[model samples]
Target: MRRFKGFVRGVDGLTRDRGGNFAVLFGAVASVLALGVGFAVNISQLYNARSSLQSVVDAAVTSTARDLTLGVIKEADAKASVQAFLDANSAAGILQANQIVLDKLTINRTAKTVQADVHADIGLYFPLFSVGDMQRVTTSTTALYSDKKIEVAMMLDITGSMAPNWRSKTDKIGDLKAAASQTVEDLLKQNRDPGDPRIRVAIVPYAEAVNTGGLADTVFVEAEGGPKVPPPIDTPLSVSVTTATDKCATERKDKDGYADYSSDGPYTLRQDNKGKTYQAKVNRDYRMKVCPTAALVPLTADMSRLLTAIDHFQAAGVTAGGIAVQWGYYMLSPSWRSAIADACLGAGPTNFDQKKVAKIAILMTDGQFNTAFARSRGASRSQDQGQVSRSNAEAICENMKRDGIEVFTIGFDLNDPSMTTTERDQAKSVLKDCSTDDSSSLKHYYEAANGAELSDAFGAITRNIENLTINR
Candidate 1:
C-alpha cells in the first residue's frame, strides 16, 4: 500500500510540471497574438493618416496648378495656396504637432507643370521594440498647365433683328450685354500681365451697318482722298455743321451781300437778322487739323468706356458680318504702323509685348452676310459681296492665319430654316477654318443655342485663357 502511494505522488508531480509548462507556452502565444493585433491596428492607422495627408497634398497641388496657369497668382501665391490647403485639411492635433512636412514644392514654368512631395511621421500604438521611427509616410503629385496666351476680339451682332427676341427669348440686348461683359471680365481676369500685353481684345458691334463712332474723320483722311470717305456717321453728328461754324467766328457766312472784308480778301462772313455778324468760318482748316486720323485705337484697361459702349449698343440697320470682320482686321493692321511706332515705340509697343505679342480676332455672328457699305453697281458689287462670301471669309481667315493672327469664331442660336443650309454651312466652315494652330488658341471656338449655354461657352473660353502657361 505504501509503495502504491509513492507512485501516485510521483505521477501527481509530473502532472503539475506538465501543467506549468503548458501555462508558459499559452502565455507566450497570447503575448505574440496581442502584439500582432497591436501592429495591425497601428499600421492601419498609419495608412489612413498617410492617405489623408496625400489627399491634402493633391488638393493643394491642383489649386496651385490652376493659379499658375491663369497668370493671376504668382509663384509665391501658389505656394501659399498649397500651404493653406494643407493647413485647412489637416487634423487639428496633427497640424499643431507639426508632424506633417511638405518636403518639396516645385513649379516648372517652362514645362508648365507643378509637383509636390509630402512626408509625415505617425505614432504607433505598439511600443514593442520601437522600430526606428514609429511610422513614415510619403506622397507626391504632378499636374500640367498647358494653356497659352489668347489674343481675342469679340464680334457681336447688334442688328435691328436683335431688337426682337429672335430666338423667342427675353431681352436680346440685355442678354447680349450680360454675356459680353462677362466675357470681357473673364478674359481680363485670365490673361492679366502686369509687364506685358499677352492678349489683345477688341469689341466690334455690327448691324446692317456698324457705327464707326465717328470714324469718318479717321477714314476720310486715311482714305488718301479715295472715293470712299470714312463711313457716314452711324448716328447724326452730335455737333451740327452750324454749331461747328459757330464755334469758329472768323469765317461765318453773312446774310449781307458785303461780307466782313479782310486783307486776305472778303472774309467769308455772314450777318444774321439779329445783326450778329456771323463770319463763315473757314473752319475747314481747323477741321482738317482736328480731322480724326483713319486709325482704330487699341483699348487698354479703359473698362469704363468699353462698358459704356456695350451698354449703348443699339440694334439698328442690317447685319454686315463681312464689314465687321474687315474692320476687326483693320483695327489691328499696321496701317498706322508709323504712328504706332512713333507714339508707342517710346513707351514700348503700346501696352503690347512687341517681342512675343500675338494678334487675334474673335468673329461671331448669328446671321448670314447680306450687305456691305462699299458695294458698287457691277463687278464691284460682286466683289464686295465676294469679300463677305463664305469663300472670302475663308480667304480672310487664311490671310490672317498666314500673318500669324489667331482667329476664333462663334455662332449663336441660329434656327432659321429660311436661311439656306449652304449659308449656315459657309459660316461654320469659315469659323472652323479660321482657328489658330495652337491647341489653346484653337479651343476658343464655340456654338451655343441658348443664353445659359452662351454664357457657359464664354466662361469656358475664359477658363482656357486663365489656364494658359508660357512655355518659355
Candidate 2:
C-alpha cells in the first residue's frame, strides 16, 4: 500500500512540472509571427506591382488609341501595340518583363474606345502554410479617342523682316511656307471623303493690313468721295460714293469703338465736311507703307488654292498683328457666314460645338507688332504701337476663347540677340497670353529658335489635337 501511494504522488509531481513548457509555447508563437511578417511583406510587394502594372496598362492603351485615331494602326494591330508597350516598360517596379503578360485587348470601334487588360505574376514571399507560390496582380485601362471635324485659321506674319535681308541671311518666309504647308496637308489628308473634308483652313497673311480680296465690299464700310467729289451742299443731292479700289483693310472705327471684337456689322461710314467728301478710315485711295498682296483666303479645303496662296506670300509691310488676329477670328466666326456665302467662299465655319467640332487659331510672328492706324492715314497720337497691338490682340483672343476657340501662338526667334530685353519680353508676353492655357501650360505656346524647331512645334500641336483621352 505504501509503494502504490508513492507512485501516485510521483505521477502528480510530474504532471505539475513547468520545465520546457515555456520553450514549446514560444516555438509555436514564433512560427506564427514569422508567417504573419512574411505575409505582410508579400502584400506590400503585390500592391506595388499592381500599381506599376496599372500605370503601364494605362499608358499602353492611351498610346494605342492615339495611333488608332490617327489611322496609323488598325484594330488588328492594337494587341501588338499594347504588347510592345508592356514589353518596353513592364519591369517598372517589383516586377520583371517576363512576369508580365497582356491578357486581353478590346477595340470598341462603335464606341471609339480601346481597352487593355494586363496581369503580372508576383512571386510570393510567404509560400508556407498551404499558401500559393505566386500572387496575381491585374489591371485594366480604357481610352476614348476621336477625330472630330476641325477648322483652323492661321495668322501668318509676312513682315519685311521675314524676307532675306542684310540683317538675316536665312529665308524665314520659305521656312514658314514649308511648315504651314505640312500642317495643312497633315490635317486635311486624313479625310476619308474628299467631297466632304473634315478639316478646313484659312490663311490670313498680314503685313501692314489684311488684303480682303473680294470680301472688302462685304465686310468693310467704304468711305465715299475723293479729290473728284462734288462740292458739299446742304443736302449733297448729287454726291458720288467712291468705290473701294484697294482691297487692303485695317482696324474698324465703327460704333463699337477701336477694340471691338465682333464680326457682325454694317459698320458706320466715315464722313468729311470738306469737298474731300470721304473720310480716311476706309478710303481706298490712301495706301499703306507696305501692303501684303497675298490676300486673305477664307476657310476652304481646296489644297491647290491654299498652296497657291502660300506660294504667292510676299514679305512686306510692318507687323499688323492685331488686325491680322481680328481677320483670323472673323474667318471662324458664324456671324460672318452670310458674308462668306455672299462672296461664294464655301460654307463658312460651323457653329461652336465642343464635342462634334473644334475651332483653332495658330498665330505666328517673327518680330514685335510695330504698326497700327488710328485714322485713315496714321495714328492720332504718338504711342507705342507694340503695346497697342499686344493689348488689342489680348482682348480679341479673350473674346475668341470665350467662344471656345483654341488659340496657339508661336514666337519665332523672339529670343534672338538682336532683340532688346523689353522687346523680347513684350513679344513673348503677347503670344503666351493669347494662347489657350493648356493642362501642361506649354503645348499651346512655342518659341522656335530655328525653322526645324518651328516644324517640330507645329507637329506637336497637331499630335496634341489628335491625342486620345483616358476615361476616368
Candidate 3:
C-alpha cells in the first residue's frame, strides 16, 4: 500500500510540471505575436504620414517655382509662399507646427536658380514600442527663372477704311481705339517696373500716310521741280520782276511829265538793230511753289494726345501699308539722331535720358500695298510706287533691326497665300514675311474676319506682353 501511494504522488507531480511548461510556452508565443503586430501597424502609419507630407512638400515647391518664374514674389516671399502651401495641403494632425521646418532657401540671382531644402518630422504611431518620438524626412528642389528682356512694338492701321462706319459709335476706328486702350492699360498693369524699363511700346498710326508733322525741316526737303532742294534764298533775284509804275512815279521825275506809265496790255520787250528786224516777246511766268516735307513726332507715354489724335483720324485716299511701315522705321532711326539727342539733353525738365535703352516698332496692316500719292509733272520721282514694295519693306526691317530697333509685324483679317483658294493671299504673304528676326517677338498675328476677333487678337498680344518676366 505504501509503494502505491508514493507512485501516485510522483504521477501528480509530473502532470503539474507538464501543465506549467505548456503555460510558459503559450505566454511566450502570444507576446511575440503582439509585438510583431504592433511593429507592422506603427511602420504602416509612419509610411502613410510620410507619403502625405511628401505630397504637400512637392506641391509647395511647385507653387513657389511658378511664382518665382512670374516675378510676382521675391525669394523671401517664395519661401513664405512654399511654407504656406505646405500648411494648406498637409494632412491634419500629422504635421505639427514643430514638425514643419524650412532648413534653407537659397536664390542664386546670377545663376537664375531657386533652391529650397525642406525638413519635416514624422511622428511615431506607437510611442511605447519606439525609442524616438519622430523620424525626419528631407527634400529639396531647384527652379530656374529666365532673365531675358522682351522688346515689343505696337503698330496700328488707321487708314480711310478705318472710318467706314464713322457715323456710328461702334465704328471700326472706335473699336480699335477701345481695344488699344484696354491693351495698353493691361500691359502697363501686368509688367510694371519702376526701376528698369524692361519693356517699351511705340505706336505707329498709318493711313494713306503717317503724318510726320513734327519732324525737323532739315531732315525733309520739298522738291523744287524735279529734285528736292534746300530752302530758297530771299535775295533781290528772288523778288517778282513785275514793274511797280505807280509807286516808282511818285519817287521819280519823268520827261513826259506823266505820274504813272500806262501800257495797253501786259509789258512786252522789243529789240531792233538798224531797222532790219524787230520782235516782241512776253515775260517769263513765275515758278511754282513746292509743298514742305512732313515731320515725325517721337513716341511718348502720354496717352491723352495720342488717343485724341487717333480718335480724330480721317482716312482719305488709298492704303500704303509698306510706306507706313517705313515711316514707322524712320521714327526710330538715328537719322533723327540730332533731334533725339537734343530732346534728351534739352533744357526741358522732361528731357529724355540719352542712356535710356533703344526703341521698337510694331507694324500692323490688314491690306496689301495697292496705291500711293500720284506724282505730278516735273515733280521729283518718288519710290516708283507710293506704297513700299515687299522687298523694300524687308530691307527696311533689316535696317531697323541693325540699328537695335526690333520690329513686330501682324496681318489682321488677311488670307494666306499658301492656301491657294483664299482671297487676299498675296497680302497675307507680305505680312507673314514681315517680322523681326526673332519669331517670338511677333507676339500675336491673327487673320480675323470680324471686329470681335480683331479685338481678341489685340488682347491676346497685350496679355502676352504683360505676362513676360525678367528674373534678373
Candidate 4:
C-alpha cells in the first residue's frame, strides 16, 4: 500500500513538471512546421515544372503548325516534329531533358490546327498525406494556321551598286538571287497544279526601269509621236501604228491630268474635244536609259520559271526604285488583272478579299531612288529627280496600303560607307514609309546587311505571311 501511493505521487509530480511539458509541446510543433515547409516546397516545384512543360508544349505545337503551313513537313510527321521540339527544349526551366513526354499529338487538316499534350514527372521533395511522392504536370497547346492564298510581288534592285564591287568581293545580286529563290521555295509548294494554285509570286527586277517584257504593248501606249487625244473611248489603236517598240516602260505620261501612278487603265487611246485617236506616250528620255537585263515576271506558281528568272538577274542602270514600286503595286492590283492575264500569268491577282487572299509586295533596294519622269504629286523636298522619285513612291505606297495590300520593304546595304548620309536617310525613309506599320507580332521593315541576314529576313517574312495563331 505504501509503494502504490509512492508510484501515484511520482506520476502526479511528472504531470506537474512545467519544463518537461514545454519540451514535449515544442517537439510536436516543430514536426508540423517542418511538414508545412516541405509541403510548400513541393508545391513550388510542381508549379515550376508545370509552367516549364506548358511553355515547351506551346512552342512545339507552334513550330509544328508553321512547318505544316510552309509544307516543310507532312501532317503524318507532326507528332515526331512536336516531340523533337519538346525534347530539344525540355530543360527550359527546372526541367530534366528526358523528364517530359509527348503523350498525344493531333494534326487536324480540316481545322488547320496542331494540338499537343505533354506531361512532365516532377519528383517531390516531400510527400504528405493524400499527396504522392511524384507529381505529374500536364499541359496542352493548340495552334491555328492560315491556309490563305498568297500573292507576292517582289521588287528586287539590280542597280549598279548590287554588282560585285571591284574594290571588295561583295556580290549583292548573287545574295539576292539565292535568298529570293529560297523564299519562293519556302512560301510555295512544289508540283502545284497549273490551273489551281494557292500561291503565286511575281519577280520585278528594276534598275533604270521595269522591263515589262511582253507586258509592254499591253500596259504602255506606243511612243509614236507625243500624247495625242482621241477617237472615242472604245476605239482600238490603228493597226498601222507599230506596237510598243521598247520593252522597258517608264512612268506613265501625266497627260489629260490623269493619275500617273494609277494602275486602272483602259491603256488604249483617249478622247479629246474632237474625236481623234492617240495614246499616252512613254517617256522618251527615261526609256532610253540603260534598262535592266532581267525582266519583270508576272505572278505565277511555276517554280522553275520563277527560279530561272532570278538566276538570270544582271545588275546595271541607274536606280529607278519608284518605278519598280509602281510596277509592284500593279502586279498585285486586280485592276491590272486583265493585262496580266493577257501575258499568260496564272489567274492574276484575285479580287481584294481580306479573309481569303493575302496580297503582298516586298520592295528591296540597295541605293537611293534617283530617277523619275513623272512630276511629284506630293510635297517634294527639292523637285529634283531624287525627291520626285521619293514622293512618287510614297504616294503609290499609300494607295497600295489603302487598297489592303500589305507592303514589306528591305533596305539592303543602305548603310554602306560609300553612301552619303542624305542618301542613306532618304533610302531608309522611303522603305519605312512603304512598309506596313505593324505594332503586333512581326515588323514589316528589314534592313539586311549581308547575304545571311537577307535570307533570315526573308524567312521571317514568310513565317509572318503564313499567319500562325496559337491557343492554350
lDDT sort, best first: 4, 2, 1, 3
172-265: candidate 4 lDDT, tens digit per residue: 9999999999999986663244566778899999988888876765444434454422223445557333444467876765545233676654
**Local accuracy of candidate 2 as per-residue lDDT tens digits, 1-472:** 9999999999988867955797799999999999889988888888888888898888889888877665567778989998988889877877786667888888886687888877888888778566688777888899986656778999999988788655566888988999988988887776656777777899999988888886776433334332322222244534533345567877754322334555543222234344333322332224355558899899999988899999999888798788888889988888777677878988888887766678889999998887765322233445677767777788789989999888999999888787899888988989999999867434799989889999998888776655412221
Per-residue lDDT of 380 in model 4: 48
Badly placed stretches (over 4 Å) of model 3 are 1-101, 119-152, 165-170, 190-199, 216-219, 228-297, 303-305, 331-338, 341-360, 371-388, 401-406, 415-423, 436-444, 466-472
Measured by lDDT, the strongest candidate is: 4
- Runs off by more than 4 Å, candidate 4: 1-19, 71-125, 131-140, 189-196, 222-225, 228-240, 257-259, 265-287, 376-382, 467-472
Ten consecutive residues with minimal summed lDDT in candidate 3? 245-254
Candidates 1 and 3 compared: the better one by lDDT is: 1
Model 2, residue 91: displacement in angstroms? 10
TM-score for candidate 3: 0.56
Q: Give the runs in model 2 whose Cα sits over 4 Å from its true position.
A: 1-52, 67-126, 214-216, 219-246, 255-259, 265-289, 375-387, 467-472
lDDT of 2: 0.76
TM-score of every candidate relative to the true structure: 0.61, 0.72, 0.56, 0.79
Better of 2 and 3 by TM-score: 2
Per-residue lDDT tens digits for candidate 3, residues 155-255, read: 57765555555354435666676766666555444344544434334455665444444332222222224212111222244441232111100000011
User: What do the candidate models score in CA lDDT, each in turn?
Assistant: 0.55, 0.76, 0.50, 0.78
